[model samples]
Structures are given as C-alpha cells and as structure tokens.
Target: MDFLRHVKNILHTYWIGFVCLIYQVLWRPKELKDLQQHNGCVAIVTGGDGDIGMETVRALCRHGMHVIIGVKEETNGQSVEAAIKATCPFAKLDCLPLDLASFASIQKFVQQFKAKGLPLHVLVNNAGIMHAPFAPTASSSGSLESHLGINYLGHFVLTRLLLDMLKRSGTKERCARIVNVSSAVHAISTIDSIKEIQFSKFYCPYGAYGQSKLAVTLGTYELDRRLRDAEFPITVNCLHPGLADTNLFRHLSPVLQPVKNLCAWLGFMWTPSQGARTPVFLSLSEEVEHTSGKYFDNCQAVPSSPSSYDVRLQKELWNWSCEITQLPCDIQDEINIHYT
Candidate 1:
C-alpha cells in the first residue's frame, strides 16, 4: 500500500476501520439529477478565493454543483470566481463576503443565504487563519490568540447559522454534509490548557494553531453526536487536507518560509491542487454517504487523534466555541458530548 494510505491504519484503532468498511459497503454518493435546477442543492465554501479552496470550487463546478465562494472581500473573490468560470463556463458560482473573524459577518452571511430560499446541501468550512500574531476578536472567547478565534470559533458560528438550511436539504439518508477542514498537525494538538480556549492571553503559535485544528476536529465529533440524538438529517465530518502550499503560512515566523520551502523542495509538501483532492473527494464521494463523525485523509475515513474523540473535550471546546461566538447552542443535558 502507498505510505500515505498506510496513514489510515495509523489513524484509526482497528475496530473503527472495520465499522467504516462495513458501513461503506452500502454507501452511495449524492444524486445529482435533482440538483440541476440549482433550487434545492447548493454548496457554500468559505475562503474559496484561492489555493485549495479554489480547487474545491473547480471540483464542484465540474460536477455541476452551484457554488458560493465565501470570502473576506467580494472584489478579490470575484476575480477567483471569474478564473473558475474561465475554464468551466457552465460553473454556477457566486462570491460572497464572509469574514469568519467577525460574529456579525458570520450571521449576516447566513441570513443572506437564507433569503435565497435555497436548501444548503454542503457547508465546507474551508476558511481559517493560521500562525498569525495573537489578537482578540469577538470569537476569541476572552482569548488573545486569533488562531482558535478564526479557525474554530468562526466556523462554529457560521455552521450554527446555517443549520436550518442544512436540515432543509432532506436527503433520504442524511440531509446535508458539514465538512470542517482540519489539519494533520492535529496529531500534535491538545486542549490541556482548557483555560487557553478562553483568556488565551498567553499564546504559543504552534499550540494555538494545533488547538484550533483540534477544536475543529473535536467539534465535528460533538456535532455528529448531536445530530444523531436529534435524529437530524445532516452528517458532520472533518478532514485534514495534508499540508498544502497555500498562502496560509505567509504570516508565520520568517524562519518558517525557509522551512516550508525546504519541505516543498523535498516533496514533503503538496501543491494546492494535490492538497485539495481529499476535501473534494470527501464532498463528492459516494463511499462516505453513510459516514459521519469521522476524520478523513486522502478521501478515505481515518481515525483522528485520541484527544479529538474525547467527548468531554468535544463538549468543552463546543461550549468554549459558543461562548466566543455568543451564539445559542441547544446541546442538552441528556446528550454526552466531549473531546476524544
């Protein structure tokens, strides 16, 4: 087997793999015949202006899915949209403003989307800020670091905002897919300093980045459980798009530039096109139709770090995330939620 594929065995305990394999035996991809009218199915992608996000746009377009590229700005996003249209002229695409760092922006975008009166089929929470300096935002949950605030908290709010739209899709098995983009570095992440999720005044760049990714992964598990209990139609899953050569690291310490360059030179890194394959495959794959609450890599289901599966931590991070977003979370006392 390819070394990259071997990573799957390393990720999941043997039992989880068996369960996934059995569930996938009857799996089916989303049917495209009905989505043609662009009435019931639409994909909303955050940070879709460039890099891996753009490649996802291309994939969705190729499959004839109407897509919305959510970005921090319209003009810049439009240029990317035009570029996408240049190749797939039939691509139904729109660019919307979405600053994940702002709670208001998150709410506003969802509200606008609802006004479109279209059922949202997939929400690819693809936007995130990485390795930036410590800064505070409404999504900070009293934390000084921007990594968790933007990467995890922002998507938290946005997903909450669109939950209704996701439910309305009403596919027979699952209504919609909420795919949160996480990272491979999650193997090194932990939420031990639970205090840091809030009042993160003391910051370590790597820790904060890892924590943010961990939070996204953990959130997927919690959301998956919640959906199951509520018997909701949506399926929640998260995946790591193996280190892509996107602009995500421009703000990292200058030394990282050389490190990134060296990694790419040595083939340890992937170009945005290569990195996008998993997310695109996850979004388009029929094999995963029955899969939920799992972390994936290279288009296949894999086990995330043990910390990511802890229900307690998942709950903690979910609460901390909601606190930061100041959004209402309907999690109940009866449900068991935690971080792995």
Candidate 2:
C-alpha cells in the first residue's frame, strides 16, 4: 500500500515534474559571460578527464579562473591540463593526481595545495564511478566495495583535508561553495553500516553507488549544520548531476551494459555538457549563496527524498565516515569535515 501510494504521488507530480525536468535538461543556462574576471579564484574539479569534469574546467578557464583538474592518474590528468592551455591560453589550469579510492593521494594533493599558500575559492567534488563490481583501495579498510569507498569515502576525506584552504577562501571574498556532485540514484541507496566500516561483505554495485551518493548528500546536510554553529561564512550545497554519458559508467557489469546504453540513447541519461551545468551553477551562481545545505536538480531546490533529510541518518553517516577515514572524531573534526 505504501509503495502504491508513493507511486501515485510521483504520478500526481508527473506532468509538472516532467516540465521542470525538461527545462532543466534542455535550456539550462551556462556561466559563459558571468564567469569572466574570476582572476584570483582557484577552483578544483575532480574527475577532470573526459566528461562533465572536463567541461567544468572549460567553463572555469573561459571565466579566467585558475583551475586544478583532479584525476586518478598522471597521464590521463595531465592531458586535460594540456588541452585547457591549448584552447584557453589565458586560462591558468593545473592537474592533481587524485585517486578517489585512495586517502594518501588525497592528502598528498592537499599538502601540495597548502604549500602554494593560496586560498581555494572553490572545491568541486566532481569525480565519481558507477556500477563497478567490488574493489577496495589501498587506504580503504572497508569491505570490497568500489562505489562506497571511492564515490563517497574519497571525497569525504579529501574535503576534510581541504577545509582550511576553503576557510581561507571564505574569508577573502565569496563565502566559498563546496559543490559535491551527487546523483538521483541516492534516492535508491541506503547504508548497511552507518557508523563503522564493513569489510569482505557481499556487495550490490548499483546500491553501493547510490549509498555513496546518499552519503554525499548527508555529508552536505551535516556540513550545513556544522558551519551554522561555527558561524562560518561559507556555503555548502549538493546536487544530482543527472546521468551523463561519461567514462564514469564503464564500470557497468557486462550484463547491464545494454540497459545503460539504452538510457543514454533514450535521453534519460544526459550528455556531459548537460550534466555539468548544475555544478557550474553552484560554483558561480549569485542565487546559490542564499541557499545553502540544499540539494539541487535541474538548478532548483528539491526535496532529496525523505532519507536525505533525516538528521539521525546524517549523523550516523558522518560518524561512519570519520571512523573509516580514521580522522579525529571530535566536534571540531566533525564540523570541519562536513563544511569543507
């Protein structure tokens, strides 16, 4: 009965929802003109290799912002930096080798940034992989789960590492927006262990991916609360990038490959450019500063399913993240981890 009622509610909102979805996908705006004069801003986009991340770097370069493009490997990462320099000669762009599955890489990347002594104007957690079978990383002691470890755990650690730089950015000009590129799939995800790391467990690839995204959204909510209490000047927000046709989906098991391709062909999954627009919006939009702790889809604030707003869920996820990352589980640590 409950499921039927839920389906009926979605149907009731179906037409208007479809209209909003179409407008968001079809005619969504870009920051082409407004991004200019972003001279001192240092923006970072993870997964800056082929699809949405690359497009985001393009937008930042055109706006004259210095961008740090983060990728998993030096070879694949450096290529994007070179491409940016070629097209946008005035655009200052560098590359960071970030393995979203590894903690050492994230720490090393942060150390390099701190060495520069420059304020980070923006941090975009844009890298993500989908539907991969179980695989753990060097830093992860968790069970054999790729999506949970990389998609969620990776950014949670990286964001915490970079929070000081972000605080510096907030003090300078715009209260920086830490944009976590989340997904609609989160609505389908739930954590099995919301307070501790689990290992060697049976895994569901898609469910794990969704769970990580749910963590991402929960992390954002937790961030909002922490920053508010700290009186921090920065804004933290999240969004579902919509399904984009990117290499990120190469993880689909062979059996599900056809269905994934079909979604792209049918326009259910978006193009890279389309998928990247909302991140760009959160990064540069004038209106978003006023709306924090919100998850956006199609450039508008929308409820992120009932689970996302559950404070208990957010805390449990946050605590679990801290334990997995082995970070200090202090109030300050929790606050810093969430907001940045």
Top candidate by lDDT: 2
TM-score between candidate 1 and the true structure: 0.82
User: How would you encode candidate 1's per-residue C-alpha lDDT over 171-218 as one tens digit per residue?
Assistant: 766458888999866665655646745422345555567668888898
Provide the clash count, candidate 1. 17
Q: How many residue pairs in model 2 have overlapping backbones?
A: 1
Per-model TM values vs. the true structure? 0.82, 0.84
Which pairs of residues collide in model 2?
A: 143-199
Residues forming the 10-long window of minimal summed lDDT in candidate 1: 331-340
Tens-digit per-residue lDDT, 1-340, candidate 2: 5355334433433343354456545754443345435777888888889699998888877877788888788898778877777888787888867777778778878877778777788889988777666777667554537777777788888887877677767852468778998877677644445642232334455555666778889889998898777767678899977656789768655886797687678776678888788888888877776568999886778888687888987888877777777776553544333222
In angstroms, how far off is 323's CA in candidate 2?
A: 2.0
Top TM-score prediction, candidate number = 2
